[model samples]
Target chain A: ATTRIFGQARFTCLILFYVLFYGTYLVSGALVFSALEAPIENQIRLDLIRAKQDFLVRHPDVLDDDLESLLDEVVRASNHGVSASRNVTGGPNWSFGQSLFFSSTVVTTIGYGHVTPLSQPGKLFCMIYALLGIPLTLVLLSALVERLLLPATALLRSLNAALGHLYRPFTIRLVHLTIIVTTFLVFFLVVPAGIFAYLEPEWDFLDSFYYCFISLTTVGLGDYIPGDSPGQPYRPFYKIATIFYLITGLTFLMLTLTVFYDIPQLNLSSVFSSIKLDED
Target chain B: ATTRIFGQARFTCLILFYVLFYGTYLVSGALVFSALEAPIENQIRLDLIRAKQDFLVRHPDVLDDDLESLLDEVVRASNHGVSASRNVTGGPNWSFGQSLFFSSTVVTTIGYGHVTPLSQPGKLFCMIYALLGIPLTLVLLSALVERLLLPATALLRSLNAALGHLYRPFTIRLVHLTIIVTTFLVFFLVVPAGIFAYLEPEWDFLDSFYYCFISLTTVGLGDYIPGDSPGQPYRPFYKIATIFYLITGLTFLMLTLTVFYDIPQLNLSSVFSSIKLDED
Candidate 1:
């Protein structure tokens, strides 16, 4: 009875700790994104207003009683990534290169929807592509992660041997996990974000990082696509490279998750099961 | 040597079969979506052009040679779901109900970026919310699936008993799996799609199904969102109900996957490991 009670207590405490940790993480993200995006959003708004003013100055006769409303409509649409005038020309979104990239994103379950298929056929194809591609991607990712796990395990074993006398196995494993996570953050998040911030004229570091976080987690909101800038050189090549980056980054993410799950104490699934045992 | 050869042959056949199946599925979807969306896209284009022509007629002075260019730009922006005029007004997207719905989407990894966080604070909160919410959602879904599996297994056992003498165990299990899959499709996909199609003015059955499938799979492309139309009756209530629907649908999805994974013969992970064994 006492043991059961103790187990229940621990489980409750762990749940509480998890909630607290998650809350802190979210609040911190909000703070960081707010700081980064606020100034940018304001700048964009100002630029948009200036553009409107310029258009008005050029054509004063266009300014009627409805001019304010029309201008407001234009600005609102721009904020939502739309424009009022239809003259802005880019090639078809479903060009071969773009289509292939879109297909890759769909299969990976990223589904950015920034450049969606307008035709029914395209939408249908997307669904069909996703059904098969998702599982295939899963299998491929798992296989790669499985391969990576061998080396990761070897590293853990070495750490265990080196610290077996000085520390508990759990402590050593946690350290190993931290090292792997930091490596992921540096290579996938930090370095790539820096490159993206540099390459994309409009994006700041936080935007890039947010994009990375969103994509890596497979949330893929599609608000901040990398290479859609007008007159971007070698756009297809850039897109393909981005695809490769996503594939590799996803593999590393899975590898990190594999390592995290290996530490049974940190496993939420196991924790929940144990809590269930206490109830039973 | 013979067994290894057989395993390799099987693996090769499975890969080919998977590709063929996936390709066919994608092609069919393309065909369907093409047929459905072509007319819609055309109608939308026509309406946009009309809107622009009307605006020009109202302000004849605005019709310079540049008017054509300006109109085109406006149309192009609208096609991409952007707008130039900011006069159109609606309630804030992050209402208490909408925020709750958004939070649900984020944690589930559906991430329909259609209605994203514009404010810095909102974006930061979103990231932090996702960081913790995802794992918690996973834990909750897994626990629910685990419980469901008991009854599911019992159902499988009964099927085994009834079919053991006439059919192989593998055949029986496949039949059992088919039944469960059908149930999931009926309850989660078909029925809900019917309801959503009825509620959303623009959505047809296929669109609703696509939405459900996309959301459940966590692809969340965000082309079609529920309850976003202006002045929809009981908007908050509808949004909350949609949130519930997603949670339940996701739980059922996890259950279906659990059942699928329980079948050892269909296990891709194990198959890969066995192939590795042959290589070793």
Candidate 2:
């Protein structure tokens, strides 16, 4: 009974500490992001406003309201991933290649959302598709990660045998985690970022790296899609290759996570679960 | 030896079947989404082009290249969440409230991408923030869900006791799951969607529900966001409320999954694990 009471107290403390930690992280993130992006956003807004003013000055006969409405239409179309620029020669957003990319993003929950379903029926279909596809993707990823763990475990065992007297188990596990994380970063992030940077005309190394990070993390802010630049060659093949890269990268991420969880000292949740708190 | 061989064979078949199933699903989804959305997308694209042409016709003195450049600028600004419309009175997209929303979305991996960080530093900070925040969020949600499961388990125990004589354990568990799922749907999806539909002038029930579904799934295609309507009153309050809704709804989702995985027969991963293939 005493242990249970103590466990409950510790649990509450742990929860409180985490909540505080999370809250601080969020507030700091909000402040940092706001500080970082607000100036740039304001600058862009001002530039656009000034451009609109300049256009009106140049074309005096163009009614303000008409231009506003035209701009609105253009903005709305752009929001739907339909470019108004005449130079844009890519097929429509819902073409087979883009649709396939959209479908893959949906199932994997990366959801870059550059091209979402606009029609009502399309939205209904998307919801239904995601309902089924998300779980299927999860199961498939888990199964693949399970398979990948065999080699990872083999590496760990070999390391353990070789260094049994030299280091602590925790140190050895940390080393194992570092090696796997480095491999994951190299193959899934750095190499992929380099490839994306080379392929995308507008994206530099940083932008490409950000895309890989955002995508593999499943944040997928959709600000920079791979093949959406105006007139890419072999768009379908590029999209398919990205789809494979995403799936493979996600599997490696899961593999890393599984390996991380295997080290008992590193698994914080297990520590929490070991505490025997009363149900009530 | 016979069992080992059979297990290996079954595992291979299982992997193959899953791969085939996922491939078919992706292909069908691509087809369906393409069929449903292509016409609408093309129509929108044509409409935008026609609007541009009409504008050019009205303002004969306006150079086509100049107008195109302006439109491009407008589209680029709009993609960054800045409206070119003079009537847009809302503060910049990176206000504390919206940044809070963005921070939450990033940590949760929802990543609406409606307003992403444009600066290089912001992007770097975003990645680092997400790296730390995602794990913190996962831990926090797991802790909260662990707490929530107490009542959920109690409910299951009572249901078992009530129906023990009349029904099998599986049936009782199914009933419990059904009740929980209904409650989740009602409280999180249904009620919140209704509120959103009522609050946002443009969103109907379907749009609101889609937003809820997409967000809760962390797909966050971000075609729709709450509190983004022009000149909305109390925007910050509304955004904070949405943050709370998302976090709570996510916790409930995790709770449902915990209850779901508790049922022995329903746990397919456990069955697979039990097959016990050789490590090699």
Two-chain DockQ for model 1:
0.27
lDDT of 2: 0.90
- Fnat values, candidates in order: 0.26, 0.82
CAPRI-style docking class of model 1 based on DockQ:
acceptable
Off by over 4 Å in 2: A1-14, A275-280, B1-10, B275-280
lDDT of each: 0.71, 0.90
The candidate that achieves the highest lDDT relative to the unseen native structure:
2
State the fnat of candidate 1 relative to the true structure. Answer: 0.26
| Model 1 B-chain TM | 0.75
Q: What TM-score do all the candidates reach, one by one?
A: 0.78, 0.95
Interface alpha-carbon RMSD, every candidate = 5.6, 1.1
lDDT of 2 by residue, A42-120 (tens): 8998899899999889888989999999988888888888888777777778888888999999999999999999999
User: What does candidate 1 score on TM?
Assistant: 0.78
